[model samples]
Target: MSGGVDSAVAAARAVEAGHEVVGVHLALSRMPGTLRTGSRGCCTVEDSMDAQRAANIMGIPYYVWDFSERFKLDVVDDFIAEYAAGRTPNPCMRCNEKIKFAALLEKAMALGFDAVCTGHYASILTDVDGNKQLHRAAAWAKDQSYVLGVLTADQINHSMFPLGATPTKAEVRKEAAERGFSVANKPDSYDICFIPDGDTKGWLGERVAPVTGDILDREGNTLGQHDGAVAFTVGQRKGLSIGTPAADGKPRFVLEVRPISNTVVVGPKEALAIKEIAGNKYTWAGLAPEHPEVEFACHVQIRAHADPVPAVAQVVSTTAVTGIDGTVELRIIPAEPLNGVAPGQTAVVYVGTRVLGQCTIDRTVSAVPVSTPEMIASASPVPVNA
Candidate 1:
C-alpha cells in the first residue's frame, strides 16, 4: 500500500476477495520525512505509518521493506545520468520498471507470494492462450498505463491492479471513506517523489554543475547563452532569456541540448516537429507484434497523460555489434508530427486499449530540416571550460 486512499481501498478489495493479502510499503529513502508536504512527496515515514494503520484495520500482515539502496541506484542515479546526458527521462517509468515490478516482484515470488498487487490504474487481461496482457484502466482520466509500459510479459503475469475497473478516482476515495481509511481524504502525491519541493532544476543543478553555455540557432549562429545545458530541455521556451529575438520576431523553443559541447540550440517552434523516432532498447508487453520487418498500425504515447497518436511502427536491424548478431531498433512514424520529443523519453505503443509495447527513444527525425549543411559545419561550439 502507498498510504494513499486508492491503495488502501485496493487492499480492502483484495482482502474481501478471500485471498491472503500482505501490504508492503517500500522504504525508498534511508531518511524519509516524518510528515507529507501535502502530496508533494511520497514513500516518507508518514506514508509508511499510514500504510501500517490501514493494514492493521484490514487485519493483514504488513511490513516496510528497505529498498533504499536499490532505489537510489536504479531510479535516482539513473535519473541524474540521463539529465547529465542532456536527455529528459521519466523517473516514474524507471521506478515502475526497476523497483516496483522488477525488484519488489522478485522478492515477493521468493517469499511464496502469487502476485504483487498495487493501486495502479491499469488492468491485466488474460488472452485465450492464457497470456497476460496489460490494458488501460476504465478510468481514462486517471489512466497510468503509460508509466506501466515498462512491464514485460513475465512481470504482467504476476501483477494485479484492483483499481483498474473503477470508473473514477472519486469512487476509490468513496470506498476508502466507507472502509474508514484515514488516507481516504489524503492528498495524492505529485511531481518527482524524491524532490518534494518540485524544483527539479535546482535539484539537478547541484549534481550536474551548471556551466555557462552558448545558445545557438539551427543556422549555427549564436543567439544567446545559458548557465547550464542540463537545466534546459527540448521545447522549453519561458526561461531561455535569449535577449535577441528571432529575425522573424517570433519566440524560439529549445530544440536540443548538447552536454559535450555545452550548447543549447533554439529554433522556430516548427523545428520541434518530429516525423519519426527510433530506439534500440525496445520490449514487448506480452507478445511480439507480427511482421516485425513490416509496418504495423498503432498509437504512440510519449508522456503519461499525453493523448496517443495514430502511428505506424516496424522493427529494423542496424549495424552489427560485438557479441550480438546486430543492433535492432523499433521505429515509429506518426501520422502527424510529434512536437518536442527528445532522446531518453519512453514511447508507449497501444493497440486500442491494450498496451502493445514500448521503446526508449534514442533518435528523432525532424520534420523540418536546416537550410544548409555549410551553416551547421560553420557553427563552432563555445566551450564554457575554455
Candidate 2:
C-alpha cells in the first residue's frame, strides 16, 4: 500500500476476494522524513505507519521493504544521467519499470506470491490464447497506462490492478472510508517524490556542475549565454533572458540542448514542429505486430496525461553490413506534426485503449527546413531503415 486511499481500497478489495493479501510499503529513500510536508512528497516514515495501520484493519500481513539502494541506482541515478545527456526523462516510468515490476516482483515470486498487485489506474486483459495485454483504466481522467507502458509481456502476466474498473477516484476514496482506512481523505502525492523541494533545476545544478554555455540561433549566431545547457529543455520559452529580439519580432523557444557542445539552440516557435521520431531501444507490451516491418496505424503518446496522437509506426532493421544483422528501431510518423518532441522521451504506442508498445525517442525530424547548409548537415533527418 502507498499510504493513500487508492492503494488502501485496493488492498481491501483484494482481501474481500478471499485471497491472502500482503501490504508491502517500499522505503525508497535511505533517509526519509518522519512526516510528509502535506502531499508534496511520499515514501516517508509517516507513509509506512499509515500503510501498516491499513494492513491491520484489513487483517493482512504488512512489511516495509528497504529498496532504497536499488531505487537510488535505478531511478535517481538514471534521472541524473538523462539530464546530464540533455534528455528529459520521466522518473515515474523508471520507478515502475525497475523497482515495482522488476525488483519487487522478482522478490514476490521467490516468496511464493502469484502476482504483485498495485493501485495503478490500468488494467490487464487476457486474450483467447491466455496472453496478457495492458489496457487503460475505465477512468479515462485517471488513466496511468502511459507510465506502465514499460511493462513487458512477462511483467503483465504477474500484475494486477484492482482499481482499474473503477469509474472515478472518488469511488476509491469512498470505498477506503467505508473500510475504515485512515488515509481515506489523505491527499495524493505529486511531482518528483525524490526531489522533496520540487526545485528540479536547483537539485540538478548541484550534481551536474553547471557549466557556462552559449545560446545560438538557427544560423549558429550567438543570441545569448546560459549558465548550463543541462538546465534547459526543448520547447522551454522562459528564463532565456535574451536581450536581442528576434528579426521577426517573435518569441524564440529552446529548440535543442546540445550537452556535448555545451550549447543551447533557440529558434522561432514554428521550427519546433517535428514530423518524425525514431528510437533504437523499444519493447513490446504484450505481442509484437504481425508485420512490424510494414507501417501500421496507431496512436502515440509522449506524456502521461497528454492525448495520444494519430500516427503510423513501423519497425525496421539496421543491418551494419550486407549480410550482418544489427539492432532495429521503431519509427513513428504522426498524421499531424508534434511540437517540441525531444530525445529520451518515451513514446507509448496504442491501438485504441490497449497499449501495444513503447520506445525511447532517439532522434526527431524537424518539419521546418534548415536555414543554412551548416544547419542541414547538423540536424538532417536520418533514415529509419538505414
Candidate 3:
C-alpha cells in the first residue's frame, strides 16, 4: 500500500473478501522526509505511518520492507542514465517496471502470497480462452493502464488491482472515510518522490558532470550554447538561449539532443511533427502474437493522460544500429500527426481499452520539409504499419 486513500480502500476490500491480507509498505528510499511537503510525493516516514495506521484499522499485520538498494539501482539510476543519454524517460513507469512489480511481486510470491494487489486504476479481464488480460479501468478518468503497460504476462497473472472496477476516485475516498482512515483527505503525490523540491534539472545537474556544448540549427549553424546536453530534451522550446528570432520570425523548438556530438538541434515547431516511430526494448503484457511481422490497427499512446490516438502498428525486423539482431522491433504510424514523441519514452499500443504491448521509442521519422544528411542517414527506413 502507498499510504493513500485508494490503497486503503483496496486493502479494506481485500480483507472483506474473507482472505487473510497482510499490508506491506515498501520503503523505496533510505532517506525520506518526515512529512510530505506537497501533493506530489510518497514513501516518506509520514506515509509509512499512515499505512501502518490503516493496517491497524483493518486489523491486519503490517510491515515495512526496505527495498531502497534495489530501487536506487533500478529506478533512480536508470533515470539518471537515460537523461545522460539525451533521452526523456518516465521514472514512475521505471519504478513500476523494476521495483513495484518485479522486486515486490517476486518477494511476495516467495513469502507465500497468492497475488500482489495494488490500487492502480486498471482492470484485469478473463479472455474468451480463459487467459487473463489487462484492461483499462471502469473509471475512465482515473485509468492508469498506460503506466502498467510494462507488466509481463507472468506479472499480470500474479497481480490484482482491487480498485480497477470502481466507478470513480470520489467513491474510493468516500469508502475510505466510512472506514475511518486518516489519509482519505491526503492529496495524491505527483512529483518525483525523491526530488521533493520538484527541481529535476537542478537535481540532475549536481549528479551528472556538466559538459558545455554548442546548440546548432538544421544547417549545422551554431545558434547558442548549452551547459550540458543532459539538461535538454527533444521538442523542448524553452531555455534554448538562441538570440534573435528566426528569419521568418517563428519560435524555434528543440528538435534533437545529440549527447555524443555535444550538439542541441533546434528547428521550427513543425519539425517535431513525426509520422512514424521505431522502438526497441519491447515489453508485452501477454504472449507474443502469432504473426510478428504483420501490421495491425491499434491506438497508440505516447504518454500518460494523453488520449490514445488512432494509429497502425506492427512488429518488424531491422538491422539498424538502434535495433538488436534477434530482438523484434515495433513500428508505429499514427493516423494523425504526433508531436514531442521522444527517444526513451514509451509508446504503448492498445486495441480499444485492452493493452497489446509497448516499446521504448528509439527513433522517429519527422514530417519536416528539410533535413541534413546526418538526419537522413541516422534514421532507418520506416516500415509502413498499414
Backbone clashes counted, model 3: 3
Error of 2 at 15 (Å): 1.0
Model 3 CA lDDT for position 128: 85
Instruction: Give the Å error, residue 182, model 1.
Output: 0.7
lDDT (Cα atoms) of all candidates against the true structure: 0.86, 0.87, 0.85
Model 3 lDDT per residue over 1-386, tens place: 88988888889999998878999999988773657786867988888999999999999999999999999999889999988877888888999999999999999999999888898999989888888888999988899999999998899999889999899898899899999999998898888888888999999999999899998888899888899988888878888888968989999998887777878888899888888887757877776667757888999999999989999988776665434455457889999979887788899999888988888787777877674554412233333332
- In candidate 1, position 106 carries an lDDT of 99
lDDT computed for candidate 1: 0.86
Q: Arrange candidates, best TM-score first.
A: 3, 2, 1
- C-alpha RMSD values across all candidates: 4.9, 3.1, 3.0
Stretches of model 1 off by over 4 angstroms after superposition: 320-325, 373-386
1-386 per-residue lDDT for model 1 (tens digits): 88888888888999999889999999998764657788798998899999999999999999999999999999999999989888888999999999999999999999999898999999999889888899999988999999999899899989999999999998888888888889988998999999989999999988888889899888878988899888998989999999987889999998888777989888899988989887777888988776778889999999998999999999876443212445677889999999989888999999999999998876776888888542111112111110
TM-score for each predicted model, relative to the true structure: 0.94, 0.94, 0.95
lDDT of 1 at 154: 91
Clash count, candidate 1:
0
